[model samples]
Target: MTFALGPRAAKAGYGLVAFDQAGSTNAEALASARRGDTRRSWFVTSEQTAGRGRRQRPWIAPRGNLASSVLEVLSVAPAVAATLGFAAGLAIETALRQVSLEAALRSGGRASFALKWPNDVLADGRKIVGMLLEAEQVAGGLAVVAGIGTNVVAAPPDIPTPAVSLADLGVQVTAEDLFSALSDAWVEYFGIWNEGRGFGDIRKLWLERAAGLGQPVAIRSGHAIIEGIFDTIDEQGCMLVRTAEGRLEPITAGDVHFGSVASQGAV
Candidate 1:
């Protein structure tokens, strides 16, 4: 059950710094970037004490789960940098399929893994993986950390968003095994991303595996609520929602609700 990089990642010159426990793998990766450790690397752990999700929400990975982040230094604008999350989503979804035989068998079915808009991987419409992208201005370039957390053995209780773990769905996988798969898949998707140049391909693949495409969606952005059909993401990764009036509105950031939750207009 030791954590180690897959052959693909290692062969691609990616470094690894595995932690038994950490406050936040993303924070650790960013700190390393600030310290001029700009080499592309992954900071991963099974237990995270103080992680943050979108809008600064706390996201802790309890024991037996996976809390991992990979640092990439690139010469891309922040707008382009933001699109990397899509690649991260694809990586984890691909990895989940690779590690879990059940996940592979269920692919293209209702209970398969799919990417929820922005930064979540859903299994049977319940979230199993959450991702966060953080960036900082460094000496050489933009340092971006893609943080990925997977519920391996257990999911948090009483969460606003429905959550599920691999074990819960009958796909038993260890954190170490999952990370190995993830590292390999990341190498593939990261190459396709090509520091954002390959985002077009990523976007296309993402839309193909999107969870709520063509469904009613309600996005809570600040104090405004925008309700519409999930149209697609634009070239720059802004979510394009087709409203009732037939106008396509671009959402830069928001909390997306779908299905019954969107019907009720809940956050």
Candidate 2:
């Protein structure tokens, strides 16, 4: 079936495009942007055959989940554009909270969710969502593709750690519902970001929902494993890790292992 944008999508202030299935929403959004589609838009897919993670790892894309990308043209510098990923992450977390709250109003249960530093969402300490943001410089501006995937009904089976789904938490959500919530949340989050907020508000919200703060963590970058105390996120959204030798390291990029201090692993 050919995918079409939802009726309420265009009203959200972005051109919305859909696909029945695709390799990756980010990839499709990038291709669309390269072909002169200038309007801020969203690229969504029901299934992704080759979805990717931050370090090019394969992101699982099961049916009956949320898989989409937001393509935005930014006049901000690369440093600021990079923080857009964190802003997107915050938006996703807010969207999940909205769904969870609605579910709670019906079921009388509390929402038990948290966000991993940078770009992962978790429920009961298991991953339920992942995000990937890609950016490229265009002629007069920058195009950013913010890709997000959430396990609404099914989580991937081959992950290195435990995973969870919204259904598993007794929350019945449709992909369309998630997309709607996400669109609303993104509008709010990006508005804050574009106003020169400089990630201060984003960092605060993320930290409130963040997991593993003040805990021991092992961050792997390439072949090096740096063990430190996960302190807090800095103004730029970098993880602040106080190493064992009294040095506070600002981690710009790495695969973080929560509560792990034994060995270093590939990031």
Give the Cα lDDT of each candidate. 0.91, 0.80
Shift in Å, residue 101, candidate 1: 1.8
Q: Write one digit per residue (lDDT tens) for candidate 2, span 1-267.
A: 343443444565678887778889999989888887868898887688899888788886878787989999878777788888877888888888888888778885445778887788888888888999888887647988889998888888878657888888888767778777888788888877773365788777778878889888888787877788889998777899998898999998887788633234323
- Spell out the clash pairs found in candidate 2: none
lDDT of 1 at 81: 94
Per-prediction TM-score: 0.95, 0.90
Error at 98, model 1, angstroms: 1.3
Best by TM-score: 1
Writing each residue's lDDT as its tens digit, candidate 1 over 1-267 gives 779999999999999999999999999999999999999999999999999898888888998999999999999999889999999999999998777764546552223788998999998889999899999999979999999999998988756689999888787678999999999999999999998899999999999999899999999988999998999999999899999999999999888999788988855
User: In candidate 1, which residue pairs clash?
Assistant: none
TM match of model 1 to true structure: 0.95
